[model samples]
Target: MSVIKELARIINEGVNTIQSKCDASGKPFPSLDEPYTPESDAVRIQVIADALPIIAAANQLIATLQIPAMSIIVASGYVHVSAAFATIAKANVVEALREAGPQGLHVKEIVEKIKKPMDPAKLARMLRICATYHIFREVAPDVFTNNRISSLLDKGKPLKEILAKPLEAFDESPGCAAFVDILIDESFKAAAVTQDHLMDPSTAFSDEPNQLPIQRAMHTNKALFEWYDEPGNELRRRRFNIAMKESVKFEVPGAILQGFDWGALPKGSKVVDVGGGIGGTTMALYDIHKHLRYVIQDREAVIKQAQQVWQTERPEALENDTLALQPHNFFEKQPVKDASVFLLRTVIHDWSDRYARTILTHLRAAAAPYTQLVLVDQVAPLACSEDGISDVPGATAPTAPPPLLPNFGLAGSMVYNLDIQMILLCGGEERTVLKISQLLSSAGWKLQRIARVPGNLLHKIIATPA
Candidate 1:
């Protein structure tokens, strides 16, 4: 068969496979344009995994055969500054438009409401770019309104403490807001000078967190978290912290319960959420397996907020002593000893190997022989599908069908993009299965299994003592 025919056949087969999987599971495919509760379709978790290679193979062929130059133009267009307009609007326009709601607002009216008046035309142009990206809507030629996507910025009405002011209302998408804010404010600045950071002889060998692109961009010797949360940078700190929960870059917190075998522990046992922010994931876990107790440990600020969250949201659990919020810097020591499990979600990926080792070592010190360390992070797959590598004894995901990049390239972009994010933000990166196995081995743990949460960008790695 001709190459075009072969490509078409492969793409068609992928579509059929995906549809069959969805039909068997009786769930709709996940969407970017519409909101769907992932928990609603628990059985269809593997559909995306099965569909990724198919999607990648077809997309690769399309890029190779059809409109190669046009594909480049479109891809480049996507990477451009439309996100900048979203950030600006979130700061300037979104709050102002809250009362206006979906009825719509004229650019002149929007300008009148602005704290700092800019030309209406300039604001309109900004909105136009934002609309092109589907963040806001352009109902008419010049008129605009909020869509579901943009409506997330609206956080209900303001309280009497600050009447009618939108910013005081709090953010509805704190996670998303943080993700965007960091991507724009911190990550972009660091990413722009990446080659400079890498190529500089001074920085080349430095795995020290201080020697990072983020450091160069902010002109601070302090680490990203320290500098970001310092005196006047409260807004920056708050946003990034919120982003971790909201953004998987995309509850990521709650979804993890699916992958974690919470019920396996004996009744009256404890689980320690090390570096757990707000105890959201722990809460999710507790909700499912009510028999177990959870200790949520994080920085003082996070623990303070968590106290209110537990008191307000899970007062019953707090009363029963089922959930406890404790202030801890995991780097210092594991205050909670011999717990059934130590859960680390998105923790190890944020630091360099040396620092990561420190975190594991702390856990190792606290761990009893039977205690399990559950790593809730991505297990990076190979980029070239055909290149076979020996799998660690137990960790696994669905194998991609032929012709797709082993890692599913753009389909599994969360893993790859975060790899870059780690390098730019801190001196860390994601690990391959082998690297993860080695890391666990060095930390004195053995890989047991990887439990993948359906539709979740991250998965849980269950391990025990070596």
Candidate 2:
């Protein structure tokens, strides 16, 4: 069944479970038989409202799963769907051919290299399919050359490794919604059944595990935070961390670091990277300003990973007088009493407005009057382009769609889409510049300045206490 259809099915199961419980307790059940009635109407409405979170969460997990599934599907053609010949050629076969160059592999050699043995007829069929997909050039009959798609694979980028790294985390899809489904349902029940008393965090989340050392202090959830920290839960941790890292790597954080003048800071002045994961950005920054002092604050797991990576790859940076790694919980309060700059990169986006404000409020309270706050994030454009029709009569181009990368020009859109994904999975979101300004302003922060980073895909939103 389609993933969407399966999502609908899973959601209905949640609704039915709620209905069954209501019926058992003598609450009037929504009539499955009756299409619309005042008596059943209220119950049906309640069920949907309660089920939205689960439904959303389920859909997100399903989407993440599709990446790997689709990658695999593209590599190995199914019965009905044609292979992703173009993508495969660029990503896989081309790489092998580039290595061999003019002296291309024989059919048997190619099969052995790809590690999957196929009968002569099947090999012929695959080569034919690949030709249609532009994966293999017909250099000679029964012999082929790697196309662009296949070339990418030869560059040490394996389909499975590349695909798996980002999504290995977060395995529970819509099907597993029942686990957290009941908790969220109970939250609604608690709010409705009791007065404001049950709504209190202290009471509702009493049994909840301690918030994650850094990020969790800002938000709390037992199942999720623990799952994020668990060593055995490598897939969830790696994928989740990488997804967060990707936001920094591709655009905002890198740009912010690159565009801003790092060397201007006082040599001894410290910059605290609150919630910095594995010091990926920190390393990037250090590479730029080797003399600047950097303090990386994160949970033990993430901190340990960061330190290990630093020790192994950038041991010189760690050994020098320039950097220090520290663990911190931003929620309890920041550890740095004072610093030249407090860099909270992409930390605020993973929160509700209220929680985000609290985090900013804490930062504001902690900062010295002259301290600069650098919020590395994507500041959305003020307006989208209008169609050419407005400018001239009968413009032929019909508003040429935004320019894109060769294979997919919509890479920027994909980055923004991560905002929506964050919202669905963890109640976090990417923010527009205006939304960020409003949030920072509310927390007594004044927008000092905003500038796009150079040669990279992000911006630096500098703010300070009002």
lDDT tens per residue, model 1, 214-248:
99987889877668657877666555556664554
Residue 324 miss distance in model 2 (angstroms): 1.6
Cα RMSD to native, each candidate?
3.9, 20.3
Clashes of 1: 1
Segments of candidate 2 deviating more than 4 angstroms: 1-226, 239-254, 382-412
Q: What TM-score would candidate 1 get against the native?
A: 0.84
User: Roughly what TM-score does model 2 have, to 2 decimal places?
Assistant: 0.53
Error of 2 at 163 (Å): 14
lDDT for model 2 comes to 0.54
Candidate number of the best TM-score: 1
Worst 10 residues of 2 by lDDT: 395-404
Question: What's the TM-score of every candidate structure?
Answer: 0.84, 0.53
